[model samples]
Target: MNRIDVHHHVIPPFYRDALAGAGITAAGGRALPDWTAEAALEMMDLLRTATAIMSVSTPGTSFLNDTSAAVELAQRLNDFTAELRAVHGDRFGYFATLPMPDATAAAREAARVLDNGTADGVVLLANSNSEYLGTGGQGELWRALDERGAVAFVHPAELPAPEVEGVPPFAADFLLDTTRAAYLLVRNGIVRQYPDIKFILSHAGGFVPYASHRMAIAIAADTGRSILDILDDFRSFYFDTALSSSLAALPSLLAFAEPSHILFGSDWPFAPVVANQYFANGLDTGVDAANLAAINHTNAQVLFPRLAGAPITTSAERPVVRLRHTTQRAVARALFKLVQPGTN
Candidate 1:
């Protein structure tokens, strides 16, 4: 199946200089990954990936407190991606980075990127330094995304100070931040307010599958409020499998959300190198084929029609029906039946 990976990233040299100039390093103290487009494409080629929509890495835009520097950095990253996309064509598209603390500038940057057609849409931190981003000053930016039917890749940013056990910062805290943003967007009426923009959450929708009951309870406790109202709005959001291809996580997602909304992502060029192995190996997994390919590539194309180049096809394109989940024996039988010359 041809796949259009919507959650891949590219950290250009200018961003490295910016981070180093500010003495900033690491993500939650983990070393910052050294990202390059060349290595990214190599990984994609190896994975049979057709195209990847690139976003700037974390601590970007967020680290630059100076709005001007943030603007300059964003422009540089956007331009760099434009050049990459130009060279690679649709195989490499980009989501724009914005200067967020200053919402006005953020809105301006969104316009600059989208209006110029330099990017497909915008990529924003889910939580801007500890607070949930709702339909507030950020609304100006959302409005632009909504107006253009743009793709908004909402990656969870640095979580609040508290870190829970049994799950490290990246696995637990980052995932928790993602759930928090999902809630803010759906239950808190942000997604309801801005329905036009497509929202893509990272790491398999974070803690949503585990914590969805809590969300239901939150709705029930507020009995006066409509129950399960947010579920519909949430269907609008997408999730990527990054650091979330675990036995515990992936199964719950299959149980909870449909595979059509789960996309594949590999945060590459991880500084230590061993990390990238973990990311790539997760793909040759045991998830059901229809759903797995959808997660890997098909769903992304459905969401962003512009990514039509992905080689995979979905039930959406054909009259074929798919089973939600099935046993390995059944899949093997189906595979055998399809390969037989006289099966028809």
Candidate 2:
């Protein structure tokens, strides 16, 4: 199957060098991997990934607090990716990086990148400098993206805590981090308000699908909305299978997400070649041919029509069908009331 990998990553040379210069050798408790355009292309060819939507991995520009530096770095990275897309148009596309936590700077960069066609969309870390996207002045950034009806790819970053004794952050903490961001966004009602902005959650939305009913229950209780209403909002976000195409994770993702919302992803470089191969194999064997075709490429084409160069057939274009967790409302309401004492 021809795959359009939405969750693929790019680590630019300058960014890598900057990290090394700052005496930083790792990100999210893992050592950074070496990356090159030639290497990425070779791997894509082997893996049958037709196109990769690239973005810089975590510890993004927010690793530095200076707004000026952040702006410069964001520009430089977008420019580099744009050049790559220009040279390798068929094989690569990119999500523009923005320096967040400084909402003003982020807004400016978002406008500049999207307006100039330097990106297919933008990639945002779940939290930047302990400031989650749903908090503080991030509305400016949201407004900017919403204005253009932009696609915002959400990736996870390390949480604001030291690593636990033996656990690697990427394996577990990253999941929690992404979950936290999703929770805050739902709680803040950002998803409903910004209907135009398509938020693509990486790593199968980081425990979101499995825990969505629970999340919806909490939101319902807090906002005085019905469980069903909250659940609908929770289901609206998009999910990408990066390192999460295994049997353990795929079922929940497939059940909770809209079929049209499940996009293919290969979190390359960071997720080593073997790991990528493993997940690709899992997806190949695990899903039915029809669903697999959508996850592989068609779903992504729906989100990014620019990637669809050839004529799209009707069979390949599946209408988005909303799938609900039948037991969620009854179970969640009981749990919510049980946890909150006399709130009901």
Candidate 3:
């Protein structure tokens, strides 16, 4: 369909080069994909995506570990992204990344970026160097975003844990990372206090949907609040269908998430073309017409009014281009099972 991708990644030349210079080659256990404006357009055309909201993926300039360096890099990356949006306002938009872990610097940059209209929204990693968002330290940043009614895209990053043998962090740890951030935000009353800020959780909220009741029950017991109240907080955040539009995951996401809260996300570049296509195919096949239309087009237009929209397109109306990699699909299913942290 005419999709608005809310979870696409952009690796600008300077950002990519900076990562290389730091001897950091991978993000969340996946090799960084080669990206260019031309390449991104080509993929969007293939996927029938009309507008892709870009964000810097994991291991952002936060790896610099120096406040001054992180601040400088955040500005550079945000400025470059803003330039792209300025030039390609129709085809592209961006979520500005903050120099996080340093909440003060992050809050300052957030104000500057959002005030100048340099970004459509801001992208925050679930945790920056083990200091998760939504905690007391980040109250200032949350307040800044809340005051502006800002859209915050909570993307996953590598956690502070050692790697598991034969398991990719993107598949498993990233899920827990997003879940932890979501739990913290809800548990600590950040969502309630900062009600104006809309937080979009990546990877269908990373097991939060399926395990939400467990979280609610635990928190209710701990806080002596009603389970429904905790559940309400858990459901307050938005979810993107990046790497999660499947029979297994989408069902829970659709069931648990408010219908209007689910947004389309390709996780492109990081999620290779084949993988993106696989999930797109699942979304096409699994959802009904109206829901598909909402997820792909209408919901995004509501979230980002400035982004232009086109007529809804569906695989049913067009020639079906079937996914070619059956073997890869099988492998993906197996990996998905391995990475479901809440299951065990």
Candidate 4:
């Protein structure tokens, strides 16, 4: 299967040096892994991944205290990735980094890279300096992305809360962080408001498919909106199966997500090659051939039409067997009771 990995990460030399200079040698409670273009290509070849959409992972530009420094680092990282793509155009694409929480600077950077074809899209951390994506004062950034009809990859950052002793943020907290951002986007109407910008949620939307109906109820109660309408908005976000392609998670994700919204991801280098292979194997065994083909590449072609260099087969061309709605709701209800028993 030729897959398009939307969740691959890039670690530029300057980024590593900057982190080292700041006495920050770890990200998401893990030591940074060495990376190179050759290695990434080799991994892709091993996994049969035809293309990788690269982005800088967590703590993106947020580690820099100065707005100018953050902006500059984002530009440098983006430029470096663009150069890589220029050389290996068929094998790689990149999502530009933006210095968020500094909304104005982020907006300017988004325009500079996206307008000039320097990026396939942009990557935004779930939160920057404790300011989440759907929060206020980010109208400029949203508008800029919306105007371009850009694809924004929503990656998780370290949680704002204090870490549990001996627990890594990426293990569990990252999921919650992405879920929080997705909820806020739907709650605050950013998903609906910025209709043009396609938001790709990493790590299988980080518990979103499992908890969506429950969240929809909460949003409906707070906003006086229909739960079905809120759920529809939640479903609008794209989901990439990165570290989340296990057999246990696939059913809920495949059931809740729109057919074309599920995309393949490897979370490579950050996820380690062994882990990537493990999950990729799980996905291979969990879904039928046709559905697997869609998650691997066909659906991705619809989003990134430029990747349609050869004859493209879409998911609509095959028969997909999805989990019944009754089963999905039963699972959701069980999970809801376990998580929040007293809720209506």
State every prediction's TM-score relative to the real structure.
0.83, 0.89, 0.91, 0.90
Question: Tens-digit lDDT track for model 3 on 1-344?
Answer: 67899999999888888999999888988778799987887788788887889999988767987999999999999999899888876678899889998888988999999999768889999988888876778888988999998999999998878989888899799999999999989888999999999999999999899999999988888889889988999888999999999879999998899999999999988887767877888888888999999998788888787764444433223443445556556756655554454553
Off by over 4 Å in 4: 310-344
Candidate 1: TM-score? 0.83
Model 2 earns a TM-score of 0.89
Candidate 2 lDDT over residue span 65-129, tens digit each: 68898889889999999999998875888999998878888888899988998689999999888
- Residue 244 displacement (Å), model 1: 1.5
Better of 1 and 3 by TM-score: 3
Ranking by TM-score: 3, 4, 2, 1
Of candidate 2, the 10-residue stretch with the lowest lDDT total is 314-323
Worst 10 residues of 1 by lDDT: 313-322
lDDT of each residue in 94-183, candidate 1, tens digit only: 888888766788788888878887788788887775656673566777777788887788877777676555454664677777888887
Best by TM-score: 3
- Candidate 1 Cα deviation (angstroms), residue 197: 1.1
Query: Model 2 segments beyond 4 Å from truth?
Result: 310-344
How does candidate 4 fare on TM-score?
Answer: 0.90
- Candidate 2, RMSD to the unseen true structure: 10.5
Q: Superposing all C-alpha atoms, what RMSD in Å does each candidate have to the true structure?
A: 9.3, 10.5, 4.5, 8.3
Clashing pairs in 3: 1-313
Q: Determine the C-alpha RMSD for candidate 4 after optimal superposition of all C-alphas.
A: 8.3
Backbone clashes counted, model 1: 2
Q: Which stretches of candidate 3 lie over 4 Å from their true place?
A: 308-344
lDDT: which candidate is best?
4
